[model samples]
Target: MRAVIQRVSHASVTVDNEITGSIGAGLVVLIGIHEDDDEEDAAYIVGKTTNLRIFSDDDGKFDLSALDTSAELLVISQFTLYGDTRRGRRPSFSHAMPPEPASDLFNRTLRLFEQTGLKVQTGRFQTHMEVSIHNDGPVTILIDSADRHRTRRG
Candidate 1:
């Protein structure tokens, strides 16, 4: 599993003109599940995301985590994150998992985040959707489940 995390002042996801998920002063995470990904990847992401210290601290350094700052999460499923364009002009999604597996893991991850005592919000998986993002600090981070625990100073 992989995720593109954006620190946002606000973010929202709409499906069929209905708002499925929305948040303020938090992270908008675009997630991708590969064919090889499993529950451990999902578990890893929940921890890394909730604990990520990308929020500002009192001194204005990258010193506060989502947990520390009480931030919300707007997680959107994005299979296109695995799109491969190495071969031709068109991107291929052969590297991503099938919808069934991907959706299963997607929902499972949301449940896991909730179990961790975080207020988790999510986009409609396998649906036609639109999203709006107001990025804060334009701070973005990419997390691969396998390397989720690596410290910045590492």
Candidate 2:
């Protein structure tokens, strides 16, 4: 599982002119499930999304988290996050999970997110949609489940 988390002032997802989900003062999470991802991957993402100290505190430091500020979430399924373009100009999605199982995993991940008691919203899965994002501080973070065990180097 991979997640691109964006701190946003507001965000919305529209499907065929209808607004499916929206959020304010929170994060927009573009999530992707890899072929080998499993339940632990989902859990890892949910944990990070809720706990990452990306939001500012009263003194203007990066000290607050979604849980601390009661931030809303706009979760969007985005398989393209796994696009592999190392070989050619065209990207390959062979690393992305299949739709059927991926959808199941996506829903399960949503359930896990909801358990945090935050306002959770979602875009229609497996559909063409438009996402409007008002990035706050233009803050973005990338998380990959496979890197959970790797130590960061300075």
Candidate 3:
């Protein structure tokens, strides 16, 4: 599982001219599930996303976590994050998880996020959607669960 977390003043997702989800003053997380990803990967991402100290504090330092600020979250399923373009002009998604299992993990991840007691909104899964984000501080962070696990083991 991989996540691109962007701190945003606001964000929204639209599908077929309808607003699917929206949030204010929080993070917009784009999640990509790899073929070998499992529930543990999802759990690791959820914990990291919630505890990340990307938000600024009184002295303008990055000292606040989403949990500390009760920030909202806009989660979007983004398989393209796994696009491999090392070979040619076109990108290959061979590393991405198939739709069925990916959707299951995405939903399970959202459920876990909602349990955190903060406002959690999500983009429609397996849909063509347009996402709008007003990035705060233009802060963006990328996290890969596989890399995290590898680092922990060593």
Candidate 4:
């Protein structure tokens, strides 16, 4: 599982000209599932997305998290997040999980997010969506479950 978490003042997803999900002053999460993803990956993503300290504090420091701020969430499924583009001009989605299993995992992840007690909204899965995002502080973070165990260089 992978997620692109962006702190946003507002965000909404529209499907077929109808608004499916919307939020205010929270985070917009674009999630993607890999072919080998499982419950552990979903757990990792939910834990990090809700607990990450990307929001600013009263002193203007990055110290508050979605959990601390009571922020809303707008989750969107984006299989393109797993697009492998290194091989040629066209991107390959061979690593993205198929819709059947991916949707199941996505729903489970949403449940996890809701368990945190924050308001969660979601886009229509497997549909064409137009997402409007007002990124707060332009704060964006990328997380990948596959990298959880890797050590970072100092």
The TM-score between candidate 1 and the true structure equals 0.93
Each model's lDDT comes to 0.89, 0.97, 0.95, 0.95
lDDT value, candidate 1, whole model: 0.89
- Tell me, by lDDT, which candidate is best: 2
After superposition, the stretches of candidate 2 with alpha carbons farther than 4 Å from their true spots are none
What lDDT is reached at residue 96 by model 4?
98
Model 1 lDDT tens row, 1-154? 8999999999999999999999988889899999999999998887888888898888888988888988888989999999999998999999899999899989998888788676788878988889999999999999888575566673
Q: List the residue pairs that clash in candidate 4.
A: none
Which ten-residue region of model 2 has the weakest summed lDDT?
A: 144-153
Q: Alpha-carbon error at 85 in model 4, in Å?
A: 0.5
Better by lDDT, candidate 2 or 1: 2
Give the lDDT ranking, best first.
2, 4, 3, 1
Q: Mind giving the per-residue lDDT tens digits that candidate 3 earns over 10-119? A: 99999999999999999999999999998899999999999999999999999999999999999999999999999999999999999999999999999989989989
- lDDT value, residue 8 of candidate 2: 98
Query: Which pairs clash (backbone N, Cα, C closer than 3 Å) in model 2?
Result: none
For residue 69, give model 2's deviation from the true position in Å. Answer: 0.2
Each model's RMSD to truth, in Å?
Answer: 2.3, 0.7, 1.7, 0.7
